[model samples]
Target chain A: MERCRELVRPALVEAVGRLHPWTGEMAAYALGWADTAGNPDPGGSEGKGVRQALTVLGAEAVGADGRDAVPGAVAVELVHTFSLLHDDIMDADTLRRQRPAVWKAYGTGPAVLAGDALLAQAVTVLAEAPNPRAAAAVRHLCRTLNALVSGQAQDLRFEHRPWNGPGAVGPEQYRSMAEHKTGALLGSAIALGAILGGAPDETVTALERAGRHLGLAFQAVDDILGIWGDPAVTGKPTHGDLRQRKKTYPILTALADSGRAAHELAALLDSPQRIDGEAAGRAAALVEEAGGRAATRDEARRHLDTAHRTLRDVPLTRTAAQELDTLFTHLLDRTW
Target chain B: MERCRELVRPALVEAVGRLHPWTGEMAAYALGWADTAGNPDPGGSEGKGVRQALTVLGAEAVGADGRDAVPGAVAVELVHTFSLLHDDIMDADTLRRQRPAVWKAYGTGPAVLAGDALLAQAVTVLAEAPNPRAAAAVRHLCRTLNALVSGQAQDLRFEHRPWNGPGAVGPEQYRSMAEHKTGALLGSAIALGAILGGAPDETVTALERAGRHLGLAFQAVDDILGIWGDPAVTGKPTHGDLRQRKKTYPILTALADSGRAAHELAALLDSPQRIDGEAAGRAAALVEEAGGRAATRDEARRHLDTAHRTLRDVPLTRTAAQELDTLFTHLLDRTW
Candidate 1:
């Protein structure tokens, strides 16, 4: 993972720097490369670079050199950051990676433009690829972008749905959102690697399927951690999604369950009062009591199993396949 | 113009409808294709498809069928609307085409996402072009997008600069902003048509140059009209830009000129009081007295001449070149 991050970081930096200086500064700040003053911030942390690693891993899985997928990786990461910049504003998240979010630091206008520039840069980078596969890469990336935006729109609307009314969010709706919001990019990342590596269409489709399953599992785990993980490890408050009344998988699962705990959890969420820490804790306990936590964990495990099963049929070398197996297992096992 | 709008409107509708339903609805509203309830609003006027017409005209100038450039035309128009959606938000303008802006009708979140989806869709539309020229089209459009974003960033930053401070806006800076903000897309519109039509590199370059001059003239005329245009025809309040203290071409030009009226206008703008109707009227008079209005009009004519001169050397057929000349002249002569 570290090696992949190192591989993709320079290209990402140079790609962002190609934007207009004003937007470039904001992009650099959002990407954790430089501070607001345009100076490199060595202490700032870039996130796990999971998407780029997956691109490389997907290429390697197709028996192609991973370096061939660097453009694809860079494009995926840019799109991811683009979404992050805009999502942070939509969600009113004031901090990212323990620093002021781009919108908070530079004001909403610049942050929005930075996101726009980054997204345009993503397509530009792919179009500049020195191969015929560039066209296919662009097409796939655009589809992914459409899905990401759609998912985000749906997620925003979901927030306003009645807590327990007929139009309330359900596990199915949450899973659909997760698929569009999270799965689209991951699937695109894997498919990009395969297409860029000159893999067959069948192989690209299979890789995309595996990526979708992996994304579902990844998001499910993230939802669980949002409510249950340690703040120190998760970088989010315990029951954070619950306190905010986010219709995450666990909360929706609990809402759907037919039991006293489910009713109580719904009542707590539907209340007009803000959920303070104590109420958040009680809400978490109610979710657990309604079997929501276990259900979410089981759902994640099911998706992980599907990913493994799908990969088993892929024609990867033994070494590459084993690496993927280990990586998937490790990812689902992380406490954060 | 009506014939061209008829030609492009269906495809534009189809293109936006391809987005997710929610974003599609917002996009439709933003584009004036539909109302808030997703019904076609007959009274809602779609802006003249000027960019698309330029694109088709560009293709015809290169001896290609105008229909051949529809995809490119669609891409350019999508990008134009995409910038409009975001710019309306940044400018905090509640109205567009005499209707409430997208961000005003729908909340900012959906408006932003709709803009994003439209941009991605623009790229996707280009990538789907059957010809291999699609890649070049995407690249040019991306460059145009970068310029548009940069221009917008500059425009936003210009708003906060002191009227006569060290960082105050000047004519050159304002012209650069106009070139990027308005010129880039127009230039891209022509270039995309040429590229899509399989025009030689030289032809594409000439068309781009012509487009840039036209853009500069377009914006300069827009600035002049903003203050002096008849409200009954222009559909904007008298001195609307002045009321908002927008550093438009005329204002910036007047600021840079050395004269008594220039200093007085600067002081009036620098004052803490808002420019209401009386002050806006006074400011307009002072700007004219400072030679700002005349200068802006002269600048527009100069760029119009440049565009005509550049087109004179291009290899377009007599009919097509004459068509472009008449169109450019007609456009610059419009009162509203």
Candidate 2:
């Protein structure tokens, strides 16, 4: 993953630089490539490059050198950053990667415009790619964007009401939202990589399925961490999702459990004038007592298992399959 | 122009519907095709369709049926509305087309997402345009988006300081900003239409130049109306730009005039408090007194004449050229 990210970093930087000079500067700052002054900033934390890794690995799985997948990798990364930048604004998050968010540091207007510019540049880079499948890649990316935006719109509308409010979301709806928000992009990353590398249709479809399951597993773990992980280890506040009343995996699962503990959890969340730490702690305990935590863990494992099964028969080389198997295992093995 | 707009309305509606069901609703509302309840709103005022007209006219000039240009037309109009949705949030404007802005009515989060979705749909529509130049058309649209975002970023930055503040803007800088903000899309509208309609390379280049000058002229006239138009007729408050302290074409030109009235206008704008209606009136008068109004009028006429001359030799049917000449004259004839 690190090798793939490092290989694409220069091209990604060059692609962003192709934006108008002012937008280029703001995007550089947002991407951790530079400070607000346009000078390089090495200390800023960066994303883990999971999507880019999927792209490269998918290409290699099709017996193509991963270098040809760099453009697809860069395109996915740009789209990822674009969503993050806009999401931070919509969620009113002040911190990202342990620093002030782009909206906080540069103001909301520039952050929004910079995100828009990055999205445009993403399509431009793909269309300019030296491949016959560039147009198809652009179409896939746009479809992914629509899904991501739809999921975000649903998430925001969900915020206006409590978990038990009218038209309440159930576990199924939550799973679908998860797929739209994260799985769509991850799936597209692999599909675009395979298409660009001239992989067969069945191979692309198989990789997309694997990537989606991997995304689901990854997000499920993230939801669990949001509620129960030690702040020291996870770098997130304990019971953060409970305090925010986010309809994450565990919360939705607990609500659907429809038992005494689920009732108590809902009551506690409904009483919120913003949940205090103690109440958040109690809420987390209630969710666990309702069997939500175990169920969520089972769901994550199920997705991971399905991901492995789907990749089992794909026509990848022996070494490529082994690498992909290792990759899925590593992704799903993040600390609970 | 109205005929062209009406002709493309159904296709535009269908194109937006291709977004996710949730986003399609919001985008439909933002585009004024539907109300907040997701039902058609016939009374809603439509866009002037200048960009779409350029596309159809460009196509007609190249001896193609205007139907072949509908996709490019829809693409440009989508991009235009996308900018409006995001810019309304950045500008904090409460009203658009006599209704509450999308951000004001549907909340900022959805407004931003809907705008992003529209932009993606724009590219997707072009990529699916069934033309050999689809990829090239997508590239042009993306490039235009980058320029538009860059111009908006500069516009927002211009808001942070007085006219004479460090990195102060002059008339030349203002012109570049105008070109990027409006000219880029308008120019691309014509260029894309021509390219997709199979116009010769030189004719495409000529139409692009003509479209750019037409955009500058349009903006210059809009600046004049922003200050001095009848409120009932323009549906805007008197001296709206002065109240906002916008460094519009007239203001920049007056500031560069370096006369006593110009100095007084600068001082009035530099006053720490917000400019009231009374002060706005004074500023408007000072701009006119400093020859800014006449200079701006001259500038608009110069661009219009250049546009006319540039299109003179382009190989178009006599009726098409005559139609275009009438359109340019009509655009520049807005009452002050």
Candidate 3:
């Protein structure tokens, strides 16, 4: 996967430059660099680029040399960027990757527009691709973004209206939300790669299923790391999700499976980042005590198993598929 | 234009249905319908399909039967929907065409997703349009959205941080912002029609220029109405833009050129949506007193003249082009 990024980075940056040109410099800045005033800055965009990695790996695994996959990679990454930009605004977060979030540094306006620009750029690049496969990939990319937003909207609604009431929301609600928020994009990323590579329909579906579970496991792991992992490694504050009162899998589990401790933890919820450190710690402790942490970890492993299982069913090149499988498993190893 | 709507409405409805199917039902309400939440009540989405009309008109003026312009019709409308969705959040607007705005009803998260969904659907629709020219139209569509957002970001910034401290924005700033915010998309709409119809590159450029001026004229007329139009005709309260403290051409002129009245208005300048009714009337009076309203009207006339000149420069089928020219003039002929 790391090797995949080295292959994709230069193209990614170039495509990004075209995505938001100088006249729209504020949008470019809002995307990943610069402050609201459009001053250039480094370190604004930093993610694993896992979706892009999937695109390259899928294309290569199917013998496309990844040239055809460039559009797929760019389209997938752009969609992800769109989500991140808008999500930051939607969630009202003040930070991303330890820097001022695009919305926070630039503004809600540019931050939102940057996301739109990226999405629009994705379509442009995909449409201009010489291959017929590009059209299918673009269509898939659009649908993926559409579904992801639906999932995100549901997640947002859960916070205010909840599934039932205060202390409501069960595992199914969390599952659906996570599926849309994380799984849909991941599935689309892999599927697009297959589309670019012209993989058989059955194989493409299998790869999508594989990515979907990986995304779910991947999200559960992220949820755990958001609470229990080392902040130095995760690059996010300890219990950041907890403090936000995010209805994450672990929190939802404790609230559903445990009684008294769940009530006590629920009592501590506040307006996300506005919550005090003490309440955050107390909430984290209660999650562990209620066995929610162990349950979430177990669920993540199960999802990973399901992901690997789906890969075995696909008709793929042995050597290429093996590399992709390896990449898939490593996605959640979390030890860096 | 009514004929255009007859063909495009079903598809637009379906495109919007993709907008956060779960939570975005609220946004659906804001677009023109009501939902079961007993909120997000009905309004109107009943605009003449001017964008697609231009596309079709462009096709007819050339030779293509307008089929190539269909995707662009949807694309332009989707961009409009996306802009409205975000503007509701940025401006903290409460209603759209007389119903609760998407953000007001759905919350920012779902509202944002609704916009995203529309963009994706628009892209997907363009991808299916069966011609490379349609694909090029897709490119035009995306570029327009990017520019629109840039202008929107600058507009928001103007309210919070003025470009030149304590003074009116220069005419160039207004033109720049207006071009990006208004002209870009409309220009794309016109250019797309020409391109889709296989017009010569020269003709496309000419039509794009015509559209740009038409766009500016359209916006100026809108701004004029925003200040002085009857509420019933415009479907908004008179001077609602003033109440929002939007720095339109008329107000900026008065503030830049007038004396005592400008001082009084400037005191309420930084505030948004805080001034209404008599204050709104007073603001209008100041613009008129300082002759700014007359100047703005003249500027709008100049834009219309430029549009007419460009239209005259282009090759056009006599009847179709003549009708289009008439439509062009009639856009600014409202009583307001």
Candidate topping lDDT: 1
True contacts recovered per prediction = 0.70, 0.74, 0.68
Candidates, ranked, lDDT: 1, 2, 3
2 against 3, candidate with superior DockQ: 2
For model 2, the stretches where C-alpha displacement exceeds 4 angstroms are A37-39, B39-43
What is candidate 2's lDDT per residue for B1-336, written digit by digit as tens?
888788788889888878777678877777777788888888567767888988888888888888888899999999999999999988999988877889887887778888998998888889889998888788878778878887887777777656774567878878888898988888888888888888877888899899999989888999999888888878889999899888888988898777899899989988797888888899999999998899888888888899899889687867767878888888778795
TM of each candidate vs. truth:
0.96, 0.96, 0.82
Q: Please provide, for model 3 over B213-292, each residue's C-alpha lDDT reduced to its tens digit, 9 standing for 90 to 100.
A: 88888887888888888999887888877877777887777777647766666666655446768888887887777666
Q: What is the lDDT of residue A264 in candidate 1?
A: 95
TM-score of 1: 0.96
The total number of steric clashes, by the backbone 3 Å criterion, in model 2 comes to: 0
User: Among the candidates, what TM-score does chain A have in each?
Assistant: 0.97, 0.96, 0.89
Predictions' DockQ, in order: 0.77, 0.71, 0.46
lDDT of 2 by residue, A1-336 (tens): 788788888889899878878788878777877887778888676778888888888888898888878899999999999999999998988877766888898888778888998898888888889988888888778888888887787777677656785577878888888888988888888888888888988888998888888888888998999898878777678898898788888888888886899999888877747797898889999999998899899989998898899889788877767877888899877678
Docking class of 3: acceptable
Where is the poorest 10-residue window by lDDT in model 1 chain B?
Answer: B1-10
- Output the lDDT of residue B330, model 3: 79
